[model samples]
Target: MNRTAQPAGTPVRSVPSKFRGPFVRWPRIADATLALAMFVAVTSLEEGPGDSLVVRPVVDLPPAVLLLFAAAGAALYWRRHKPLAVLSVALAAWAPMLGSSYANVGGIVIVALYSAGRHTQDRRWGPLGVVAAVGAVTLDGLLLSLPAGEIGFGCLVMLGAWYMGRRLRLRSERAAQLRQEQAAEAQRIAAEERTHIARELHDVVAHRVSMMTVQAGAARMVAAEDPQGALEAMTAVEEAGRQALDELRHLLGVLRPKAERDGLGPQPGLTDLPRLVAQVREAGLDVSLTDDIRAPLPARVELSVYRIVQEALTNVLKHSGPHTRTEVRLGHDQCGPGISIEVLDDGQGAALQSVSGTARTTGMGGHGIVGMRERALLLGGTLDAGPRPGGGFRLTAHLPVQPVLGEPA
Candidate 1:
């Protein structure tokens, strides 16, 4: 994803009400106030006795002319909904005033031009309205023999008002588009996080459940032959159930809202491997571990590594027989800046053919191998799993590590 960087300390600007829609808060009242103000200003204008320009006092103007000016100002109340119509009415009224004492009705024209540019939904109509307004002002000035400079100044002022409104409208559109993009990005990230949590739950629950299943089966088989051995197997099954609930509770806590969640236990890491190995031993798997890591890794990397190893051992127990010997080795890579891991098992048990057949048919038990590979790749690592040429299963992974700031590489 690409993001545009905003300047440091720059404040975000919200879209203004004028650009949001045709009306603002209490639209009728606001329009009435503006119209009344324009009427008062135009009526208050007066030409001094010695003035060269043709202007007049409101009291001296004819009643029809006064009514025309009043009508022009009144038309502004509907400017938000009918901007072009209001502009046309104002210009028509102003045309009669030109060369007369009240030719200074351009204020009404300016307001109408702004409303037309800001409120018009059709793109073509706004520019067309502006052009028509400017042309009317120019033609009226030429017909009345008004000074060229005066006409040019009026046109420029009206165009400036229209341009200001148009610019704000475009800005409002861009801000709305940016907000929509941000919302979509947030939803996408949330979906991905949910998927990751589900995979973690699967790994945690599957291993413990598989252990309990094996232990319960063993206990049933030996109950008649060896009462003491059967009791031990049942005890192991109970312990596995308790551990599964504990880990499930720990994982589920994350799904709760922050205010409702209590403090959770720390996730298993490299230091927890001994306890993990002991649990597997009780489940009847002959397993060994060799840890040669010299330096500590980041917490996230440690958690991912622990999960990869846990899932691999779970697969071994599920597919390979309990008597098969497995070895787990962890160490820093001798040739690169990374950690290396390996899990291997000897195919000496009765279930070796079934394990190899499952590997060939189903690609290592559906979601298990895929989950392990996802964990490794997320940490900038690579994983490989398959049957060895010498008649066993082999899983290897290499995870790259970045040195922490202020730490030696």
Candidate 2:
């Protein structure tokens, strides 16, 4: 039995959860025991005023009434699995017991009506059972020449039994439907998380791999003419490859069960931006980073800032001209309590054009920009990425951050 993670405000049954386990595990045994108890109780009824609702029953009752009571009780065993048929059998036995001293089988009929309501497959079966039970009770009333009020009372009692059964059945169906809906919602959320993880992998791995490929190509080109340049390029390639591997391991660590990820290491955040910028510079691009926000930020906010800058610089490395110069700015905005990040590059505007096929950021056309924007939106922030008015590309992101109260802002 797979459990679903229900969202807040999802309904829970009033019944205690503890009993559900036992009931589900041994339903047949429980049903059989109840049937046996009803059988014994019904058989013990004797000739008395309250014994039979049949008003004027006197003479010696035939032994066949005992058999009818026994049959009705036996039918209770299969009440849940075959509700309609079980109720029919119980009613058949019940009609014959009306004029006798053994009218105690009325208990069995009530249980059967409730069972029919609770477990019947067809929705129409409940109402039909109500009619049948009422008719049976009405005919018994006529046979015993009972008054109108007594007959109506018996009919109402049977109707109530059927109504209660139907109510229980409806509630059970509703609960099952809610469980199904909850499962579907859980699956949808899991899929979104998986998509987020894939995007993170692409942003991290693609950038590093792109740099390595460029460096490897440069090494090959300069090997004969500039041995020192070639050596430096190879060094950059080695470093990029190592960083790519480390990031990959970190991303994959999340796939482990929570308990197993105890020592997997922390995620890279804004604090690690200097090392990141250094590696980007070694990739042969002219890049500089300026940081002024000394306050600690939330982990997710820090990660979003890092990826935004990283993706911008990656685009510079992949799609910009050789002379491209990039600047990264990070600081807390004085106008509001938020962190602001800007990545600008004089990269011939090709990267922006590559991403903006529609000339608007609203479309979320590319995975890189779309993913970054989604992260920002999730954190109640915003991002803008496109060509600058001058002759370059620019990416800006802002995320609201509330400093721990009574602590540094």
Candidate 3:
């Protein structure tokens, strides 16, 4: 069916309440019409206890006329939203004739029984229906005016249908509960796996990338002035690359046994700052650095610091075409007991140019600054990248003293 309801289990009931009609009201009305049509077509069977109904004591309904009035009541039976109200009205309308043993009016009661059960997928509608049907049939037949056999048969039919609806509703409820539990469990497992992957990546990837950054810079520096010394730094970069690849491969294998099919990732980090400077220098740019980092740094913090520098310098190398001197400064300070790294380029910085003249500057960054900031935050540090005070672009990051992973809780 083209339904908006959940596909798995017990559906939320849409009862015909005082506010709105149930979705099944129209279909119910159709069912009633079909039943009445069947009865009308079989005109020969109109031999209900008409004489018996007239002399009946309780529920004064005339059996022969019950079906006609019931067909009319069926109109409102479609609005079974107010179940008790509708059923009471139908029953009360013919209460005087209920004394008849074969009260033909029971057709509407059968439909009502089904409607009452439908709300819960047929769960409820107690055995009281059984007792009421049996008692009413017996007492009306024996005491007032009904054939004992006819009363017995009518009660049996009503209870049977009610019982079937109750069973269907209960089964649907159980299935729905099972489906919900399975979904919740699947979500919980996925969340746990993501957390585990994050931990593994942070520990392995961050440490190797930090070391590669330093080594790459040193390699690029001596390549021209001292080619042999530069070769040694290059060797370190190659070694770091190999180690990172091997470790990542092992980690991935552990994380996903099937990942042997996928290849290894690239090697990159913060330690290659000097080589990065050399790479910039190679492309005809003046870059200077003042590093006085005495204390041992946290692995994640160091790696984040490295990426920020790498990305910021990349932006400078890409946009600051000429007439620029880049100054990179890394120092251990007591700014609430932390270490800070700052990279500033004295180029045609947008923020600075706006202050210097009435003219506008070139667009330098959009995603680069965002990337640097993201890296910093990932390592539990803060980053600030913008145009410098003088005439340049400035990118800075301040890291706490303690490593987040191993810090005393």
Model 2: per-residue Cα lDDT over 1-409, one tens digit each: 1112332233322111344553468989988888888887777645456545333332344668767767889899998889899888988888766764466577788889988888876878778878988888888788778899998998999999888878877888887786576445644655676688889989889999999999999999999999999999999999999999988887877754343366766666877889888877777778888998888887777777877777767667755634468889999987899988888877553233464322232222134554565567777887666555555666778898864346443
**TM-score, model 2 to reference:** 0.51
Q: Which residue pairs overlap in candidate 1's backbone?
A: none
lDDT of 1 at 298: 78
Q: What TM-score goes with each of the models? A: 0.48, 0.51, 0.44
* CA lDDT of every candidate: 0.73, 0.72, 0.57
User: What tens-digit string does per-residue lDDT give for candidate 3 at 42-78?
Assistant: 2223234443323233234455465556543554434
TM-score-superior candidate, 1 or 3: 1
* Candidate 1, lDDT over the whole model: 0.73
Residue pairs in candidate 2 whose N, alpha carbon or C atoms collide under 3 angstroms: none
lDDT per residue as tens, model 1, 170-203? 8878776765654444344445666888899899
Error of 3 at 322 (Å): 71
- Cand. 3 Cα-lDDT: 0.57
Best by lDDT: 1
Task: Count the clashes in each prediction.
Answer: 0, 0, 23
